[model samples]
Target: MLKKQFKTTRVFRFKRFARKSYSVFNSLHKTVTIGVLSGCALISAHATTVEPAERVYTQTSTDSIPPTELDEVVVTASKVDLPLNLAAKQVTVISRQEIERAPVRSIEDLLNYVAGVDILQRGPHGVQADISLRGGSFDQTAILLNGVNLTNPHTGHYSFDIPINLSDIERIEIVQGPSSLVFGASAFSGGVNIITRKDPESNGFAKLEGGMYGLFGAEARGAYKTENSLHSLSAGYKHSDGYIANSDYNIVNLLWQSRFDINGSNLDVMAGLNDKKQGANTFYSAAHPNQFDDTQGIFASIRGETGGRLKFIPHIYWSRHYDEFQLYRDGTPDIPATYKGHNYHRSDVFGMNLNMQYASRWGITSFGGEFRNEGIMSNVLGKPMDDTIGKYTKSDSRTNISYFLEHNFIFNRFTLSVGGLLNYNTAVVDKFNLYPALNASYRPSKSLKLYASWNKATRMPTFTDLYYTTSTHTGNSNLEAETSEAFETGLKYIHPVIKGSIAAFYMKGRNMIDWVKTSSDALWESRNHTKINTKGLDATLGLDLKEWFGANQPFHSFSMGFMVLDQNMVESGLISNYVLNPLHYKFTAALHHDVLKNLSLSWNFRWQEREGSYVQYVDSQPGERVDFTPFSLLDVKASYRFPHVDLFVNANNIFNTTHVDFGNIPQPGFWLSGGASIRF
Candidate 1:
């Protein structure tokens, strides 16, 4: 009955809009009349149509008579594919169309508008950033490329150093709660999975862009497909002169993917490389103004899957990363007592994963196991020794194994899922651990659903947390694993013209990790907090005016999202570095419209209020605590389409707002870029 109400309401709304629009578009009299007649007929036809077995939502395009319903499937929430409406956890899907329409140049900018996601950047154009979810630390989140883990073991700061360019991505799936039951330890807070395109049609594109601060870049992508095989390649290069002294950067990325279908089986292969060299002005220490860094990442993977009632997927992946950092510029003279040396670090991760799924009369069951080996070779980390000159020559390696199982039970309108993970690590004091989760969803009606989940997760300390040492920082190797218990509940409503959801969650953390210091002059030390608690609320609403008011309307779509978070440390009198960087409130709004038949415009806005204070340092003066101020940014994009080419221009931070996402790091201001893409 609820589903019928939704359909009727949408039809009535569309009828009202159609009748009122006849007078507005008198210039195109014949076109307007035909549109109204067709809209009414479609509404009548939709009213008489029968409900299908599976739920589907038709996404209205700018130039379509009747919307076509599509099955929205998701795979990250569980190990197996399920419709978004049936998923037990909160999931956000950013489709390829949405990605291409936005004026974002990097994955970081693309995720900035999502509710409950915080992207704290230290430089422009995604030079570096820390991704946090729901008040969790950066290390708690996991990053994946096509279901293969890409998390760096050395530090979470490099977790977003993905090798794929924007043109290579098909979609991004964000799981917004504890996902260790499906992924592994790094997924303690949440996870992000980027899916690449594998279309069977041959296509290619080339784009060139240049803008403020001497920013310029070029990117190209091409794909070839045959009946039995598909291949794709993408490459990009970007560079920028410094907005200020020693703030310049050069970035390069390359990716290749291939898939082959043979004998009722599918095999996929992927290889990628990312290299970046940038000026890091006061990135790590305020005392250093001419810092430099060069980083490179290489990743490769092979995956094979067999199709049947009983399915199996086997995968293996390898990742290698190299980092070189200089605290001072090359021309700077090394003083006797100053630390002016270059640090070189290398890390590698090799992993194997096997997944299986079975469909039976009772329910769908899935299970998986993973084996991983990771190691780091650094010039200045690990156990200190008398023979070594302030550098550890030996590599530090660790081995870990994890197995997970999940069972989904569907009966009538209710679905229940229970899962658990058993993990073992050779480096931990307790080498074995167990995590459990339970989720339930109730579809009161086809258009509305309610769900709740509870899960437990744990995270191991990173290499930086265990062995890093510097004049102003120190790390302890005796830290315990951070653990948390999370609970979440949400309600979702879906309709032809409108969709929305509201969710509330609470997390309790024990032995939470943070870098802290008691005094301004003391060295920051990595330690574990006794207790921490966080609670938050997230809400999102979207409206499709094109479907309701006809595509000729000036305003076609609008969406808004908001989040509120409150975090507290139960322990008394502790100053932290990363844990205290949560935002108190964040709000995002977006609007899209067609100004003309061939031209379109879109605008996005974000306002954020962050909690806590950071230490601000002046020249030869004592550091002072400065409360982070609230800031708002507006970004606008305009595009004009031709027969085979599309031209676009974007203005970012149009108001030239002066803001700092991190301590003493200034963000770009009033930047503009224009580009054109030609498709073949």
Candidate 2:
């Protein structure tokens, strides 16, 4: 219930500041009342208690709370804001009703049940998606939206190709490991945060969806409240016409959020706009069936926040992208100068973030700081190529600074935390970096917890990895700055009919930024020599069984999820034996039942497997080939509920399989969908 109304307003402001510090320490004498009774026994021993099946399913446990249940997540990987089981790392809370019951559209379908994630989809709906975590690379997994920093000043090659459409998410907190210490240094191979959807106080909603291969969509959200203020607005639109052969798409989004309250201090504002019209297959094959290319983009963002325990946030942004292309060699179009070309990209971002927390009598301390500035520009138009031409503009600027500190020692059943992070970066022409990190945590009980961390991160080599095209083999202006150091450990668990987590990780990278193919032609360039070693293990499991089938009103539920991953790069000349480096295994199962009682039942099953071959490019004659194969997939869904209205159905790759999550393009066979939702 609004997280127990924000935990009873932070325990009534910590019991009115421990009764005004024990009445000014008993009028300045009486030995300061034993330091105000040890700050009132550490705020009543960090109060938090509410069992009895969450106080008897306070407000219905809808389907046993397993829609990727995230019991109120808010973990900044220990820069404070705890919860997610006292965050000390290993946080995974993907929700928005599990992105609408896995209707995940993009962001690799919302990290397919995240557990050491690794996704690489080659085609279908505006193709191009390469996401990796624990197996880092997809530009070393460090993406954020809502915390802004969608990385890609061009050529970090991770632009899941537009469409963040997941119906304006309201959650997605994945802090697996090496968060580059409080988000910096490009996460080094971990950290994904995107929590949007705020400003809701009253009640308002809107939704519309269309399906099938050429899916269509619409959404509208509203919220308003007074007594101080709170407002919300959301908008969405989507289009697609792809299932293969040069995919297609169009997307638009607009969101606004606001909050205001005085006397307890609170202020928030957020704005957004994103527009895109995309269709590019990077020239698909089977003899290029009318291969076509196009791209258009526009973006905007503004944010501000300030409330309580030392807080402040500021942000600004702007973006523009446009591209027009045609290159038909076999599919005819009679090469009119290779069908003409044009490209333009622009960007600007400004930032500020700060937060603080403090609690006394020997524990709880947090600190923060952040500053950023970035600008980019790229422009190109028409002919001029024998090897390459000109008019390609470039402007680069960068600035970022960070500082952090943390502490959270609580005894009596464990609770210890320590942290550090300091980063400073500047670029306008390379060289100016300083990074650092350290972490720890341990909680012997309270549903178990244990953690560890070590960090050092950096990634800076974009501008098309130093000035775009310089033919014969792309540009590489003496790149350097892809550094890393990672170390990790994990374990988490909670109970009440089952909740879970399991983890293990290791990462080591150094100047490891690859893409090198040069022996006179085959053109591919971007380097930092290379050295990468990653290890992984992730686990998640859930079950409720409707409290042992004794259900009358706790809905009914069943769940299962599993994942495995292994990645490598032992650094033995030229990016050691690449395999697109992602050893994978995934499985999922879910069942929610009611059958009839307002009528609702849902079933979802997914399985994915791959064990080798994922290297996209590599050939200095020492190999002479490229690869991508080994695949398997499946998906399905169903829903229903009525009182106002709610009905749904879905099936994807349901037996009409035709797999290939990447390479050899083919996926999106057997597609069916139905939708309905109306509530007032």
Candidate 3:
């Protein structure tokens, strides 16, 4: 309820994007808008009745309309504020209720149930995981916190290294497609934004959890609110002896957030810090069973919106990630000195943006520019350094500039939006490139809506991909930036008893990057392929059993989802590492029911078929080539309600089905955990 009331995007208008240099960028921005609109031409469609220009632009946005059954949930679509039904792209909203009731312990696990999103986990309990959307690799997706970019510059493996506990989240918004125009080049496949809680009343909670394998965890959160401001603080710690030999982990998280209202506008500030010491046995190479890593990260951002008839937003964000990865843990009696030391890295990212928008007789016009700097200092990840800093001797840095222009139009039952992005990266390209987008939606009735969108996005290789080198691996500094042109069309149906959406999409990628080698024994090198095309179908259906069966409803909710993807790449003899292999088929189902007056249960199940193979290890050596096989997983949770607390227990991988999500990494089986929440 607080999330629905004090939505940051709606109230503060601290939207994602904005530009500087009005006079210089204005002409070029308008020309791009004209070019895209002319190329798209208006087609037949229907939508909600357009409100009068003056009232619609000012009133519909400033005032909050109570959401109905979560169907009309407000979500940010392509950097524009729009309700779910009005959005042109496929967007998924995971509400606070869903997070509280779900049978998952971490944010990464909850996202695995979504239709188009993918979470490839090497270890559980927030140790490490790679997130992707649609059929793209983990590196192609952009992860944000509170609309701020916190993704790592060294590698996608650290993108999920967020510094906050799952209890600190309020809601999550996922846009499943290319959104580079707003989130930048990394959003080639999609983007996910985690919004933190903003409580209006004074409240707090403390939780404790424990399970098998010597697992133990504790967390606490508190929030205080004044008439014009709100502040919150949360901290947590978790440890596990692991389900297998050398798979243990220890993690600590701390988070702080605040909001202040000044005049008619508002300001929001948040920061987080987390530390991790993990046993990553066989995580990267199957030959090493004693692999270990230590990670420390900090992310902070401040955003403020202030304006009258025209809105202006100023934002500043920064992140620092430090990692020490050991192929073999200390004191392992290595064979050579080259293999005796650990790899150390430090990445820093700083960004700032200024945005302006206006609403008048014409549709809303928004324009903004961003300046970003990404730099890395490491022992083995960048160019050779002439001077040393601390223990790092190598370094690299790049500057990126991006300008955005977007407009939304409403005419009776038709809604349309056109936008374009201009970007320049000093590390990859010499000049700015144009990435254009067009989206439209039609609503023939209250229950059914049709939408279509076409978008383009590009991604530059990370520091790891550009300079990493070793005896068994090599990096190609000449690799070109990859690009994708995507088109999607979908229909959403919302009814009292049945609510669902189905979409079909296609993407054409050029100059795709992949780790390849001529044969199994050759060194792995990064290379760019000519073209790769992908097509997929994603659908989800939810049934409100309560509405159908009245008080005797068999279950409170039931949902099922299916996704199939096929990718065709240029035929070659290259042995691919990341790009070629992906999930070809995936299906998910969920059921939640009340067993008694105070007891409830939830069942979650999924089946996946992947298209790839890995060199299986035997007796500490690569023995057999094993192709990926289909696997199924089932998870269930039981909860009992009390006056001020809830008791819950969950079993993941209940069937103990052996499966492989990433190369040479064996997933846990039949794990159980329990916890209790106390509120005050």
True lDDT of residue 670, candidate 1: 89
In candidate 3, the residue pairs with backbone N, CA or C atoms under 3 Å apart (3 or more residues apart, or in different chains) clash, namely 18-368, 18-369, 19-368, 19-369, 46-442, 46-443, 47-413, 47-443
When 1 and 2 are scored with lDDT, the better candidate is 1
Quick one: ranking by TM-score, best first? 3, 1, 2
In candidate 1 the C-alpha lDDT for residue 429 amounts to 53
lDDT of 1: 0.76
The candidate with the higher lDDT, 2 or 3, is 3
Two-way TM-score contest, 1 vs 2, winner? 1
Off by over 4 Å in 2: 1-76, 79-84, 88-90, 93-107, 110-173, 176-180, 185-190, 193-244, 248-405, 408-422, 428-493, 498-543, 550-602, 605-680
Provide backbone clash counts, one per model. Answer: 0, 0, 8
Choose the strongest candidate by TM-score: 3
Cα lDDT tens digits, model 2, 1-680, are: 76774344342222222122233323234323322322221110010111111111112122111112223444455554544554556677676776666644455655754545666665543245666666656666666665555555554343443334565566777765566555656666776767665534325555676787678766667778888877777777777787654566676766666655543334445556656554445332222344454544444444433233233333344444444443342455555564344445554545554444454444456666566555555553112233331434545667666666666664434445666556666752444445555555665765677777666676666555665563323556667767767777777777767777776667777776665543323455666756666666667777676776566764566666666766565533332212244646676666666666666555666676754332242221223334444444456566677666677777666777666654344556777766775655
lDDT of 3 by residue, 113-200 (tens): 8767778888888899988787787889888887777778899999888877777777788888788875776788888888777655
Segments in model 1 whose C-alpha atoms lie over 4 Å from true places:
1-70, 333-337, 384-392
Model 3 lDDT on a 0 to 1 scale:
0.76
Show pairs that collide, candidate 1. none
Candidate 3: list runs displaced more than 4 Å.
1-71, 333-340
- Residue-level error in angstroms, candidate 2, position 361: 14
User: Model 1 — which ten-residue stretch has the worst lDDT?
Assistant: 42-51
